[model samples]
Each structure stands twice: as structure tokens, then as C-alpha cells.
Target: MRKLLAATLGILSAVGGFVDVGDLVAASQAGARFGMAHSWVLLLGVVAICAYAEMAGRIAAVTGRAVFDLIRERLGARVALLNLVASYVVTVVTLAAELGGVALAVRLATGVPYLIWVPVAGAAVWLVLWRMRFPVMERVFGLAGLALVVFAVALFWLPTDWAALGHSAVSGGQAGQGWGAYWFVAVALFASTVSPYEVFFFSSGGVEERWGTADLADARFSVLVGFPIGGFLALALIATATVVLRPAGLTVTGLEQVAHPVVLAFGGLGLAIAALAFFAVTFGAALETGLSAAYAAAQYFGWQWGKRVSPREATRFHTVLLVSVLLGVLLLLTAIDPVALTEYMLIISAVALPLTYLPILVVANDRTYLGDRVNGPWLNTLAAALLLVILAASIVAIPLAIGTRMGQ
Candidate 1:
């Protein structure tokens, strides 16, 4: 039972990452316009994330250290700090999007304006981080996030043309949308699927729980099970959107629009499940991005972090946490639509993918860190190929965004 519980924590963390606000919008947008052709992006992303996250978990279990800590040691403090600044900024922007997602979910549930729920959501997120037992928080949000399976269920409930969806997944083309727009959605969906903070939080959580070599098997199992399930759920989001929203030619502008497809299939009850699913995933992920932002800062600087210690003991870490969340709140106060900020963050995420991933690939082979446990030949080959694809995506994200006006 204890093992099952621990595995659930890892899966929950992955699930939390898989269906956050950015993904909820991005996946739906991709599906509504491009159909299931972007499904491969999620598959690619899940593979890449699983590969590196396992490396990270191995490092944590073997060394009792987090990825960012090794980043500074390997990449030098100056470079890691610079990476820290960029990663921290991007992560906080993500947090703001998630906070906005939570607020939007609340509004959908209660009919209150999302703006009115923003501060309430922020405060509630902060309170949980400050006061909740870490494990309890993980379980509550993780289990609730499973409610998102309704999206997959809704796929069956609706009049889905299964063979058509399968054909789209297999045929893999832009259809009516230009290839530029198609790939743009692909990049955004991939970025959202394997966003950097998920790795930072996952490996750090392993370290926090003091995972050892014995725990490594459990860790790998969780990633294998959790991430693919998460990816499957994301695909269902797209499939649901393709079925309901694409016919209407609706563009996704918020969580509400993302939920519209489900609402069409299931009515108000579907709306309720979708709202709760969004809220739980975003709420859970807000915790991750918030912690991950701080974790990177602390690990880079070699300051102690994790909820096992008091805030005073990890003052620098807690300060970074407080500051990151505040920055997210301030960003929203500027009155930027939260959904739009998510789009920008996804682009920025595309740019930074190599920065975050290169370090993992490098460290995974460090004999000093892993000894004989370093990546074998096949894994390295796969990792290198994926790395090239990520760099290509990073290089092209801006050009495509400009050429297409962010996929107009």
C-alpha cells in the first residue's frame, strides 16, 4: 500500500504536468484546427520527458542531489545562474497561466467572473503551499486530477468517428491548415507536454523523499505509467475538440472554450467535471511551477530546499517561492489575459527546451555522477536524435510565430 501510494505521487506529479492550463488550451487548439495529427507530438514529448526524467531520478537516487544542483556543478555557476533566471521567469509565467486556469475553472463552476476568482485562487494556492502537508497536498490534487479522465470518457460518449481519428493520427498532415500552422501547434503541444519544470519538480521530489537505488525501479515505473496516461488524456482533449469544436470553427481563447466541446457532449455535468479537472490539474501544477522555480534557484545556488525543513531553514528557497508566486500575480494584475500569456510562455518554452534538456543529457552520462549506471548506447542515440529535434523546434518557434502571427 505504501509503495502504491508513493507510485501514485509520481504519477500524480506527471498528470499534474500533462494537463495544465497551457496544454488544455494548446491541445484543444491543435485538435480543433489540425485534428489528431499532433498526437505524435505528445508521443514524442512523453518519450523525451520519460528518458530524461529517469536520468534525473537516477541522479537523485544515486547522489541525493537534484538536477539543478548538478547543473551548477557541471555548467558553472555563472551559466547555471543565467539559465536559472530564464527558467525561473518562464516558469512563473506558466504559474500565472495556471492560476488563471484555476480562476477560470472557478468561474465556470460558480458563474462568477474569472477576474473576481483570480485573487481568490492565488490566495488559496499560496495557503495550501504554506500550510498543507506536502504528501497530503499531492494526493488530494493528484486524485482529483484523475477526474480529467472524463475527457477520454467523453470521447466514447460522443459520436466519434474512431477510424477517422485513427487515420488522422496515422496520416499526419496539416489537412486544410498550412504546414506552418500545423507545425506551430505541434511545437506548442510538444512544449506543453514536456515543459521543463515537470522534470525539475519530479527529480527534486525524489530527492526530497530521499529516494535510494531501491526506489529507482519504482521511479521508472511511475514515469512509464504516469506520463503516457497523461499523454493519452491530452490526446483525448484534442480528439474531443476535433469532434465538437472544429466543426464550429471556434478558436480556443480560454479554458471555457476548451470545455465547450465537452459541454456539447455531456451538458452542465460535463462542464462541472471539466472545471474540476482543470482546477485540480492547474492547482496541482501551480504548486509544481511555483516550487520548481524556487528549486532551480536554490539548487543552482546550493541552498537547502524541500518541505521537510522549516521555511526559516530554507529561507532563500522560500523567499524565491514567495517572490515567484508574487511575480505571477503581478503579471496577471497587468491585466494580460491569462490564456494569451500561456501562448507566449509556450513559445518561450520552445526556445528554452535545449537549454533545459542538454544539461540532463550531459549529466546522465557523467561517470562521476552515475558510474556504470550512465546511459547505454541506444538511449544516447535516441536522446541525441530527440535533442536535434528540440533544437530545431527552438530555432523555428519564433520564426513560425512571426510568419503566422502566432498561428493566426
Candidate 2:
């Protein structure tokens, strides 16, 4: 049962990575505009995230320290501080986008105006972080998020062209949409899949739960199972969009449009499920980004952190958590479209990918930290190869966004 409970951390992390507000928009848009042309990017992202997250989990388990804790020690204060600033800014922006997503999800379920729910969603998420136990918080939202599987079920109910999707997945193309736009969307989707906050939250959660060497198998299992499940769910989103929205030449302007395939398959029942899934994923991710922002700050400053202690004891950590949530609420109250905010956030995240990931690779290879448990040759090779891809995405993200006017 303990092992079973441990899986929820990966599930919640994957929920934040693959099906969060940004992914719902990016994945659906990929399918709608270019069919499955961007499928390879998603697959690549899953591989990269799973590999890095495993390294992170192992570091937490073996060293009895979180990634950021080691990062500061290994890379020196200057580089780590730069990474922290970039990561923190991007994470807080992500938190705001997620808060807006929660409000948007509520508006979909009820006819309430979105702005009215922004603060309400912020308050609810803050309360959950303040009151909920770590394991229970992870388990509840993680399980609820599986409701997105309805999109996969919709694939069978609809007349999906399986062979066509298979062909598109392999024979990647720009679909005459210009390579600039294609690559822009690819970067965005990749950024959504391997967001830095996911790793921050994953490693911190390991520390929060007191994982040790004995828990390595459970951590690996969570990484192997949880992220692939997220990739599959994300693929279902792409496939559904390819089947329904692409054919209709529809644009994915909002979450409701993203759910249209499911709605077509089961009508009102599908909408209900999609709404719940949206709320679960967005709300779950809000908790993750909120905590991740706090964790990164606390870890960097060498302040006391984690949920293992009382709020009064971890005053600085809890204060950062509160302030982050308030910032999210304030950002959302400005009424920026959550989907648009997600696109911009993904672009910035893509540009900052190297700052977050390169240090992980360096730390994972350092024998001082992992000793004999350090990454093997094959994993290092693969991780290095993926880092090059991350660098390329970072380099081209802005140019592609500008050339394509944010994918037109």
C-alpha cells in the first residue's frame, strides 16, 4: 500500500506535465492544424522527461536531498541562482496560467463567469495546499485526472482513421503550414511535456515523503508507468483532434473545443467527464506549480522546507507558498486568456529549458553525489542527446515564434 501510494506522486507530476492547461491547448492545436505531424515531438518529450525525472528521483532517494539542494552545491551559487531565477519566474507564470485554467474549467462546468471564479479557484487551491496531506493531495487529483481517458475512448466511438494517424505519426510534415509554424508548435508541445516545475515538484515530493534507497524500485516504477500513461493520454488528445476538429477545420480556442471530440462521442456525458478531467488536471497542476515555486525558492535559500513539519515551523516556505498563490490570483484577475497565457508561457519555458535540464545532467553524472548509483553510460548518452534537442528548441523557440507570429 505504501508503494501504491508512492505512485501518485508520479501520476500527479505527469498530470502537470502532459495534460495541464498548456498541453490541452498545444496538443489539441497540433492535431487541429497539422494533423499528427507533431507526434514525434511529444514522443521525444516523454522520453526526455522520463529519463530526467528518474535521475531526479534517484538523486532524492540516494542523497536524501532534493535536486535544487544538490544543484546549488554542485554548480556553485552563481549558476544555480541564475537557474533558480529563470525557473522561478517561469514556474510562477505557469502557476498563474493554471489558476486561470481552473477558473476556465469551472466556467465550463457551470455558467458562472470566468473572472468570478479566478479568486475562488485560487482560494480553493491555496486551502488544499495548506490543509491537505501530501500523499492524499497527490492521490485524489491524480486519480481524478484519469477521467481524460474519455478522449481515448472517444477515438473508438468516432470513425477515426487509424492508418492515417499512424502514417502522420511517422511521416512528419509541415502540412504546407510553413516549417516555422510547425517547429513553433513542436517547441510548445515539447515544453508542455517536460516543464521544469514537474521535476522540481517530483524531487521535492520525494523529500517530502522521505523516500530512501529501498524506495528506488517504487520510484522507477512510478516514472515508467506514470509518464507513459500521460503520453498515451496526450496522444489520445492529438488523435481526437485529428479525427474531429481537423476534418471540420475548427480551431482550438478553448478547453470546450479541445473536448469536442469526446462531446461528439458521448454528448453530455462526455462534456461532464472532460470538465471534471480539466478541473482535476488544472487544479492538480496549480498545487504542483505553487509548491514547486516555494520549493525552488526554499531549496535555493537553504531555508527549512517540506510538508513534514508544521506551517509555523516552515514559516518561510508557507509564506512563499501563500505569496505565490496570491500572485497567481492577481495575474488571473488581469483577465488574460488562460490558453493564450499558456502559449506564451510555453514559449518562455522552451527558451529556459537548458537552464533547468543541463544542471540535472551535470549533477546526475557527478560521482560525489550519486557515487556508484550515478547514471550509466547509455542513460548519459541518451540524456546528452536529449539535451541537444532541448538546446535546439530553446534556440529556435523565439525565432520560430517571431517568424510564425506565434504559430499564426
Candidate 3:
């Protein structure tokens, strides 16, 4: 029971990474435009993230270090600092996007404007980080995020064409959206699923919880079970959109449109449930991204970090967390469209994926870190293949964005 509870960190990280604002829009857009053709991308991303997260968890449990810490050691401070700069920028932008998501979810639930909720959301997220017990925080949000299962449930209630959905999953096409747009959405959804912050939060949460070799099985169990569940929820979002939005020619311009199918099927009750799920996942992601931003900086500098210590003890880390949330709030105050921000966030995250992932692959195989616990042959094979796909996504992300004019 204790071990099972510890998996909350994995669940929180996966739910945040797999279905935050980015996935909510990207996955639905894929479905709205291309049916279930992009389902394979989500599946591949789940496999990739699971394999790497298992390695990251193993490293943290055995070595008492997170991925960013290993990067500084293996790649030298100069290169790692550069890596940190890129990662920090991407993460802060991601933090901003999540804050916007939280506000949007609030606006969906209440009649108040989303801008009014931005700072409130940021303050609330910071408060939770400032005072909550780490595991308690993880479990609360992870459990709440399961409210997204409403999407899957709503699917069953709706008159879904199961055979057609399965056929589209097996036989992918551009659905008249053009291969360029199709692949662009594919890359974005894939990037969201394997977002770097997921691993950062996952491994850092393990370290914060003081995982050891004895906890390795529990960590692995978390990634294997938690992430796929996240992927399933995301797939349900896609399936719902395919069934309800595609034929209507709706393109999911915001969170409200994402909830349309459920609202149509179950009316007001469904809208309320969708809003709760949206708030939980986005607020949970805001927490993860804020921590991930600080985690990257603290781990890079070898500073004292983790919520296990007093705020005064880890002042620099906590300061970064506070500042990151403030920055996010400020970004949202500029009144940028949260959906558009998420689209941009996904593209940039795609470009930065290799910087975050390559070092993990290298260090996971290093006996210096894990000794006999290093990645086994099959894991290495999968990690290497996934790295190639990540690289392809990174190499092409900007060009595709430019060429397709952000997948017009």
C-alpha cells in the first residue's frame, strides 16, 4: 500500500505532461482534423516516455541524483549550463502556458474572465508549493486529475462508432488536412507526451521522496502504470473529438470546444465534470512545470534543493519556484491566447527535446551512476530508437512550423 501510494508522483507527472494544455489542444486538433490517424504518435510517445522515465527513476533511486545533475557531471559545466538555459526558457514558457490553462479552466467553470483568474491561479500554485508536503501534493493532484476519466466515460455515453474509430486508428490518413499539417500535429502531440519536465519532475520527485534500490520496483511500477493511463485519457480526448467535432468542421480553438462532445452528450453535468478535469490537470501541470523549472536550475548548480528541506534551507530553489510562477502570471497578463501559447510551447519543446533527453540516455547506460542497475539491453534498444525519433522531431520542428505556417 505504501509503495502504491508512492506512485502518485509518477501519476502527477504523467498526467501533467501527457494531458496538460498542450495535449488538450494538440490531441483534439489532431482528431478534429485527422480522425484517429495520430493515435500511433501518442502510443509511440507513451512507449518512449515510459522507457526513459524508468531509466531516470532507476538513476535517481540508485545514485541519489536527478537527470540534470548527471548532465553537469558528464557533459561539463559549460555545455550543461547551455543546456540549462535552453531547458529553463522552454520550461518557463511551459509554466506560463499552464498558468494560462488554469485560468482558462476557471473561466470555463465560472463566468469571470480568464485574465482575472491568472494571478489567483499563480498565487494558489505557489502557496501549495510553499507549504504542502511533497507526497501529499502529488497524491492530491494525481488523484484529482483522474477526473479526466470523464472523457472516456462520456465516450461510452455518446453514440460512438467504435468500428470506424478503430479503422481510423489502423488506417491513418491526412483526412484532407495535408500530410504536412498531419505530421506537424503528430510532432506536437508527440512532444507533449514526452515533455522533458515529466522526467525532471518524476526523477526529482523520487529523489525528494528519498528513493533507494529498495524503491526501484515501486518507481518502475509507477511509470509503467501511470503514464499509460495518461495516454489512455489523451486517446479518449482524441476519440471524442473524432466522433463529435471532425464532422462539424470544428477545430478546437479553445478549452470550451474541447469539452463540447461531453457537454452535448451529458449537458450541464458533463460541462462541470470537464471543467473540473481541466482544472485538475492544468493546475497539476502548473505545479510540475514550476518545480521542474527550479529543479533544473538547482540540480545544475549543485545547490541544496527539494521540498524535503526548509524553504530557508533551499532558498534559491524556492525563490526560483516563486519567480517562475510570477513570470507565468505576467505572461498571461499580457492577454496572449492560452491555446496559441500552448501551440507555440509544443513546437519549442519539440526543438529542445534532444537536449533534455540525450544526456539521460548516455547516463542511464553509465555504470558509474547505476552500477549493475544500468539500463538493460532491450531498454537501451528502445531508448536509442526513441532518441532517433526525438531527433527527427527536433530537427524538423521549426522547418515544419515555418513551412506549414504553424500547420495552417
Candidate 4:
């Protein structure tokens, strides 16, 4: 029972990352623009994140330390500091994007402008982070996020061409969108799939839950089951978009378009469910990113951290969390389009991907940490190949964005 319950950690982490606001838009955009051509990217990202997150969870369980804690020691202070700065920036921006998502979700429901809900969403997220029991928070939002399954169900109800979808996945062409735009979308989706904060939150959450060697099996279970579910949900979003929006020549300007297929299939109920799903996932992710930003800072500096400790005891960590939420709120108040912000966040995350992932790969192999529990040859080889892909994404993300005008 405990093991099953513990799976919430993985589910929440995956739910938060895979279906977060940025991913919601990015995946939809990919499908709308390029059909299912980006399916391989999602698959590759799931494999990469699962392999690394398992390493991270194992490290946390075995060493009683978060990944950031060991990163400074293993990678040197200078490199770790740089990584910390980049990751922290990306995470906070992501938090802002998520808070924006929460507001957008509310707006979708209430017919209110999303801007009015920005501060409200920010406050709600901060309050949950400040007071909610960690496990309760994880379970509540993780389960709620599964509401996105409506998209998959809609595929059957809609006039979806499964054979065409399969051909798009297998053929893997540009769909006349041009190679640059396709790869731009590819990098953004990849970044969203393997966002650094997901690992930060997952490993830190493991340490907070006091995972030990005995809990290793549960940790592995979380990684294996959680991330792939995220990928599957994301694929469903892509499939729906491919079926509905692509045929109509519509692009995902907002969540409304993303929910269009569901709405067509189920009408009012579909819209309601999609809005609820959006809110839960975004709010859930807001919590993860906020805590992750604080975790990265606290772990990097060796300060006290984690929800197990009271806010008074972990004042710096709590302060960072509060500040991050506020920043996210303020950013959204500027009326910057949430989807645009998410796109920019993905570009930055793609560039900084190597910094967040490379260290985990290095430390996972270190005898000082995992000993015999270190990655086997097969996992290491897979991780290495994935890292090369990450590096390629990082190198090309900016050029592709510039050349394609952010996938214009």
C-alpha cells in the first residue's frame, strides 16, 4: 500500500513536467503544425528523463542528499554555480508560465480575463506550498491531472484518422513546415519533456520523503511509470491536435484551441474537464517549480531545505520559494502572452539542458555515491547517447529559433 501510494511522487513529477502549461501548448503546437512527426522526440525525451531521474532518485535514496547537494561537490563550485544560475532562472520563469496557465485555466472556466487571476493563482500556489502536506499536495494534483485523458478518449469519438496518424509518426517528414520550424518545435517539446526542474523536484522530494536503500524499488517504480505516463498524455495531446486543429489549419494560440478537439467531441462537459485538467496540472506544476527553485538554491549553498523542516528552520529556502512565486505573478501581470513566455522558457531550458543533466550522469557513475548501485553499462550507454542529443538540441535551439523566427 505504501509503495503504491509512493507512486504519487513519480506521477506528480511526471504530470507536472509532461503536461505543464508550456508542454500543453508546445505539444499542441507540434501536432497542429507538423502532425505526429515529433512523436519520436517525446519518446526520446521520456527515455532520457526516465534514465536520469532513476539515477537521481537512486542517488537521493542511497546518499541521503539531493542532486544539487552532490552537484557542487562532484562538478566543482564554479560549474555548479553557473548551472544553478541558469537552472534557477529557467525554473522561476517556468513557475511564472505555470501560474499564467492556472490563470488561463480559470479564465477559460469563468470568462474572466486571465490577468485578473494571475495574482490569485500565484497566491493559491504559494499558500499550498506554504501549508499543504507534501504528500497530500502530490496526490491531489497528480490524480486531477489525469483528467487530460479526455483528449485520448476524444480521439475515438472524433473522426480521427488513426492510419494517417501512424503514417505521420512513421514517415517523420516536415509536413511542409520546413525543417527549421520542425526542429524548433522538436527542441521546445524536448525541453518541456525533460525540464531540469522535474529532476530537481523528484530528487528533492525523494530526500524529503526519506527514501532509503529499502525504498529504491519504489523510487525506480516512480521513474519508470511516472514519466512514461506523462509522455503518453503528451502524445494524446499531439494526436488530438493532429486530428482536429491540423485539418482546420488552426494553430494553438491559447488553451481554447488545445481543448478544441475535446470540446468538439463532448461539448460543454469536455470544455469543463479540459479546464479542470489545465488548472490542476498548472497549479500542481507551479508547486513543483516553486519548490524546485528553492531546492536548487538551498542545495547549492548547503543551506537547510525541504518541507520536512518547518519554514522557520528553512527560512532561506522558504524565502526563495515566496520570491519565485511573486516574480512569476509579476511577470504575468505584464500581460506577456503565457504561451509566448512558455516558448521562450523552452528555448532557454533547451540551451541549459546539458548543465542540469551532465552532472547527474557523472555523479551517478561515481563510486563515492552509489557504489555498486551505479548505472550499469546499458543505462550508461543510453544516458550518454541521450546526452549527445541534448547537446545537439542545445546547440541548435537558438539558431533554429532565430532562423525560423521561433517556428514562424
Clashing pairs in 3: none
lDDT: which is higher, 3 or 4? Answer: 4
lDDT of 2 at 47: 96
Model 2 stretches with alpha carbons more than 4 Å out = 1-18
- For model 1, the stretches where C-alpha displacement exceeds 4 angstroms are none
Model 1, poorest ten-residue lDDT window?
Answer: 10-19
Residue-by-residue lDDT tens digits, candidate 4, 221-283: 877887898889999999999999998999998899999999999999999999999999999
Q: Local error of candidate 3 at 408, Å?
A: 0.5
How many residue pairs collide in each prediction?
0, 0, 0, 0
Q: Give the lDDT of residue 301 in candidate 1.
A: 80
Candidate 2 worst ten-residue window by lDDT = 10-19
Identify the superior model by TM-score, candidate 2 or candidate 4: 4
Q: Evaluated with lDDT, which candidate comes out highest?
A: 4
TM-score, each model? 0.97, 0.97, 0.97, 0.98
lDDT per residue as tens, model 2, 198-300: 8898888888878899988888888878888988889899989998999899998888899899999999899999999999989989999999999999999
- Residue 204 alpha-carbon offset, candidate 3, angstroms: 0.7
- For model 3, residues 1-408, the per-residue Cα lDDT tens digits are 765555666565555555688888898899899999999999999999999998888999999999899989999999999999999999999999998988999999996999999999999999999998866666667777788888899889988999999999999799787888988999999998998998998889888888999988877887888889999999999999999999899988889989999999889999999998889888888889999999999999989998878999999999999999999899889989989999999999999999989999999889877789988898888899999999999999999999999999
TM-score of 3: 0.97
Give the 10-residue window scoring lowest on summed lDDT in candidate 3: 9-18
